[model samples]
Target: MNTMKKLAAISLVTAALAAPADLTASARPARATGLPAAAKGCVPAMIDNFMTGAYRSPDLTTGSVTNTESGAMLGGRRTTRFQVAGNPFGFPSTAVVAPGDKSLLAVSSGYKGPTALAVFYGLRSEAHPEVLRADLSCFKRFEVNFVANDLPLNINVEVKSASSPTVYQCGVNTEAGQTNGFRLEFPFDCFVTNDPAHPPVDWTRIDRVLLLIQSASAMAANDYAINFFRLAS
Candidate 1:
């Protein structure tokens, strides 16, 4: 599937957040020059450490499962479900608590169509799942810690806002042969949209945090271990 089309599909089905603007083919957000300096008195917050949480896995309609986990933010002990969507033709995909129960491991097999394994954050009510709104204006950037194997995978980080019809995104590409764990930082400004009329992201009304990991090729298999996702000063 085309990268832009694949991302747009995920945005539409998962949260109904909004449409995505024309994006760059490069492995980074369009119009992002570099990371900017943090603002004064900027406080740090953890989105998900993938640790210190217990969750129940329930099989979803797409043959994937949802992990209703205990979170460490938003009053601590916030219960939210992390979803796995777009597994090609119901191609088997799994999101599990990795060995040692320290990180979340997402794996996809026989990848044909773009599969987006997403982890949800912020406030949510199970009774009304679509209403997940959060305020992250206090932070200047986002930090993702994960380990990538040699397998080909396209990793994208996306954000949705309550006040706009554009979904903001930035690419976080990993080295082909690098197996070591690494941390990537993306400033909020790095997230942009091709639509100039709508804001790229409304930080104060951020409703969703989406991480998309798609197999790089057809019938390709890949896996990723996520350590944590955070917002920082």
Candidate 2:
């Protein structure tokens, strides 16, 4: 998304917030720019242009998985999962980690129909243990990207967790129907310690990852993609 366009959108949102009743009349459909006209529903377009620019040094390790093929599996069957480990690109100068800080970058191409994608990472302490909880560290973060045609995109993020089942859902953006795309970055401090209450991350043990993609409604056609990076010392 263009900076000027973002500014204009923010301005409109601010104006709407200032006067709730005048929202309907004050809010005018923004003239579409480079967006496709024939594009009826939401189409997932990769916002690669914004990422190509210069970023601070210490390049972070990054990876991604898409839901175009197998789709997300919930209960019965398994799903295709991908993983890239240990700062694939080597740590960049800018990729710095403080005592309690964790940073990440996540993005996705726009989706035309309806689709969802989630990416998560965890830090484990020590090797095997009698109690499962003893070996697990902290669930660094969880991120979700949702999109649908002719509707706005929804982006959500949460910090800290022990163990949680991954699930995906689809719905209409009834409130902000004009949203077409979104991007987010998160930073935090604190790690799962080795104590009984807060166990240390078992770096020696293998970490698990899960990705889910589901089409809840009929005539649903869309693409789901995500790229994530972790910053460490």
Candidate 3:
């Protein structure tokens, strides 16, 4: 979808949130962005443009029979059940095949619901029991390029590891959403892991990654559209 349509999605989602529980494409709340330039020593583990089939449901990858709010597939996507949710404000969400008639992933924080879906990707490591893993030791940072409804906002991200109880988490700010769209980048240390040992990030043992959003805060806003993503070096 073009930037205009993407921005308009915010209105659609807002209207949807203001209305009934069930939302339609014509008006719904939900969306997810882009990256910046490469930094030195950045090694990409796995990046998907949604153009090619890279991620799928955990079931398809692990051959397990558990039902999660799955939408991480090569050709499929998911729209959040809630158009408006969260604490102070409602946030509708979506994880669908973006570009609507094409083959790409679309994530949204259009609403502020506490519940959001996960698009699982990256490496899988038995070393980390449940989460996925990757060796990011070679790199120092990661970045992604996505469309932004607003640049001054922050988006949520989580990196899971097998070595500790808490996952690496952080809030990244959006870039210029009008001209170049949004690009966000951050170093490994920026992510806060509850383990005081903060045991060395088993870069090689990274378990899994997820794209997340709160949907809304104290106010309402537009949604974002992602175009490309990568872990920079």
Candidate 4:
């Protein structure tokens, strides 16, 4: 079906799923802070499941070296150590700022699995934050980014109770010279889900969103990384 039709179908499904009760309460969008007034960009939000590792060089002068061409004797061996850094997911944090009316919500999930991760937004201490039952009429667009290394990745974002998925193909690119730094952006209609069966019709009521990253066949260290998140006004 066409994109419009697909969106409509997902909306209908979401309405049905949310018919039981209103979970999110209507509230005014939060104002921006610590950012330039004209700087229409993203900022950091809460991060989860981040991994920590270090790069190290090997040393070869601790032991005596031996060499034998025909007898197969080899040189000395050396060991290197790696220190683990604390993962940021466990920290008590908040998005530097919240989205404005007509704002954009951006999130990153460390590689986990194929299930779309759920992201919830609400007052700092509200109960049932995941249920976005608020009137989010001001939001117009949703931009998502999945940051990682040189590996092919795909993501599908879904609003809970909706019936479709927002499919995002995270194109792979060459790793830049900078270590521990990379990002990708995928822009989508805030209301439409890439999958007709899972449209984000309830975005208007969304206080939180969930993202699911499809798993790959092979796994590698630093295989997944989610640097930051932002909500554009």
TM-score of each: 0.65, 0.23, 0.53, 0.35
- For model 4, residues 171-230, the per-residue Cα lDDT tens digits are 222332223544444233533534546434543344344333322223211234343343
| Model 2: lDDT of residue 171 | 20
Q: Output the TM-score of candidate 2.
A: 0.23
Ranking according to lDDT, highest score first: 1, 3, 4, 2
Cα lDDT tens digits, model 1, 35-73, are: 242344222376666555545344332533444344443
Which residue runs does candidate 4 get wrong by more than 4 Å?
Answer: 1-130, 144-147, 161-183, 186-202, 217-222
C-alpha-based local distance difference test score of model 3:
0.40
Candidate 3 residue 122 Cα shift, in angstroms, is 6.4
Q: Using TM-score, give the best candidate's number.
A: 1
**Reference-based lDDT, each prediction:** 0.52, 0.24, 0.40, 0.28
In Å, residue 81's CA in model 2 sits off its true spot by: 5.9
Candidates 1 and 2 compared by lDDT, better number: 1
Worst 10 residues of 2 by lDDT: 123-132
Alpha-carbon shift of residue 158 in model 1 (angstroms): 2.2
Ranking by TM-score: 1, 3, 4, 2
* TM-score-superior candidate, 1 or 2: 1
Model 2 residue 90 lDDT? Answer: 34
For candidate 3, give the lDDT of residue 202.
Answer: 59
**Candidate 2 Cα deviation (angstroms), residue 199:** 13
